[model samples]
Target: MTVVSSVKDLEALTLTIVNEFDAGVDRVWQLWEDPRQLERWWGPPTWPATFTDFDFTVGGEARYHMTGPEGEKAHGWWRFLAIGRPASLEIEDGFADANGEPDLSQPSGRMRVSVEDLGGGRTRMTIASHNDTVEQLQELIEMGMEEGMKEALGQIDAMLAE
Candidate 1:
């Protein structure tokens, strides 16, 4: 129940998910800093993610796969563009091929993750996904990106609780 709200702005070609956690910024930031913690909530409940490789530097790359209930796997990769540490991160996120290489045939997006200290051991986290074009945004939406993101983010509360 960490998610406060989710908004999809078609006109701006962005999808933003806002969440609040009853933990300090540094503690909440571990959700991204630690790959194991990330794997626990990076995907929807029905599709659990496993990070095969992770590097958190500004120019680092993270490769992962989400396995569906039916045993199907969806590959993804994130190339970090900026890392502000316990506060914000920006990356180019894209679908990947079986070999974990970026699949240009699939639309990619820029994702910005921001963590704000709400004080009193509380933190506000925001994930903003920006697509390059209207068509690309529509395509992601058609793929249930909104719902998937919501479900994925909803798992964060349990992680924080742990």
Candidate 2:
């Protein structure tokens, strides 16, 4: 219910999801700045993420895996491109193998996360996932990235409450 809008811009080959939170910008920022905190809601309830390596600096990278209900693991990686504390970040996101090698078979994207102070303790977080081609964007959507993201973000409200 915290989501404000989720739009897919086919022309731009991007899927943009916007979320609004009742908490302060700082509180929301911590969700991404802290690896442990990020693990709390980075995946859907059915698949919880565990971070193996986290280097949250510009040019640094993070490696994580999401464990499903049946204990299946989905590996992923992120290379930070730009980071603006409590405000914005840009990263190259891709699927990886257990050994941390990129999975070239899957489509990768550049994800931009922006946090805006909407005043009066309200904050807005926008995530834009961009792929190089329309087919790549469509492929990711077919893989349930949008729904997975929605389900993943839905948990944040309770996290902020705590």
Candidate 3:
């Protein structure tokens, strides 16, 4: 088990934001590491997600395909850099085309997730995403990534609170 007694304070860099969810650290970690659980809460409410090849471990890889409301398909992958059990996770994440090949022109990012158990059955999950540049951050903003994450995490809260 990862020691989540310490809270991590992160500076907001290019497109960095911290979201706190009121759930146990272990519960939050389960929502993160389990592909089925992620698919339940990780996509837009209009479009359901289906995941393939998900392995949550250091050096492991995951691939996900989400069908948009307009019937368009989006794919992505993450190369896990670190997996701190129920406490933290770090990974290099990127988007790919339908065939599962990297699109170099798309912005890639490094994401670090710190799970701090706040006791009383709550956990503050902070996500720090480092993009290549400010331009990349702006691009992601234009792509509605922030709102998407917010909505997904909101769904996570709803699901976990059950």
Candidate 4:
């Protein structure tokens, strides 16, 4: 189990997930660089994700959908704000409508992902999700974001092994 821990801070209005993988930073970074690898672990096992459009560059966008066990779909989109190769990435993430457009009515989160080389062929990944308000943060938590993220991240270990 590579997922180390998850912490939610109401005062900071952020959720952070830390994971340590038994692979090099570059190898682990490929999970985000390659759409196929990304799709394999972007969502929980029960709700596998499928990326329709993925542009892993600054100022680019990514559109994906997670299909639930009952065949229901949850659409989402990401607007890349910054990218620093295998080290870090910053993006604005939000829910999208069936038409693949962002739903302004819903709250969006600013996410920063950082990958650090831990030596010994190990990498430590940190995902920090920041919300605009505590209420919004609570809303997402109530919606099971923590568990979903933990489950989603748990899949990465297997992907990296292969």
TM-score of 4: 0.79
Q: Write the per-residue lDDT of candidate 2 for residues 66-130, one digit (tens) a residue.
A: 87666777778889999999899999988788777778887778999999999999999999988
- Cα deviation at 54, candidate 4, in Å, is 0.6
Q: What would the per-residue lDDT of candidate 1 be over residues 1-162, giving only the tens digit for each residue?
A: 989999999787888999999999999989989999998877766677898989889899999988766687777888899999989999898878878787888778998999999999999999999987877666444333444665678788778888
Given candidate 2, what's the lDDT at residue 108? 78
Worst 10 residues of 1 by lDDT: 139-148
Off by over 4 Å in 1: 133-162
lDDT (C-alpha) at residue 68 in model 2: 67
Global lDDT scores for all candidate models = 0.84, 0.83, 0.73, 0.84
Query: Per-residue alpha-carbon lDDT of model 3 for 14-62, expressed as tens digits?
Result: 3445556667889899988888998887775655667788887789888
Reference-based TM-score of each model: 0.79, 0.78, 0.71, 0.79
Give the runs in model 2 whose Cα sits over 4 Å from its true position: 104-107, 133-162
What's the CA error at residue 49 for candidate 2, in Å?
A: 0.7
All candidates: CA RMSD (Å): 8.5, 8.5, 9.2, 8.6
| TM-score preference between candidates 3 and 4, better one | 4
lDDT of 4 at 63: 93
Where in model 4 is the C-alpha error above 4 Å? 133-162
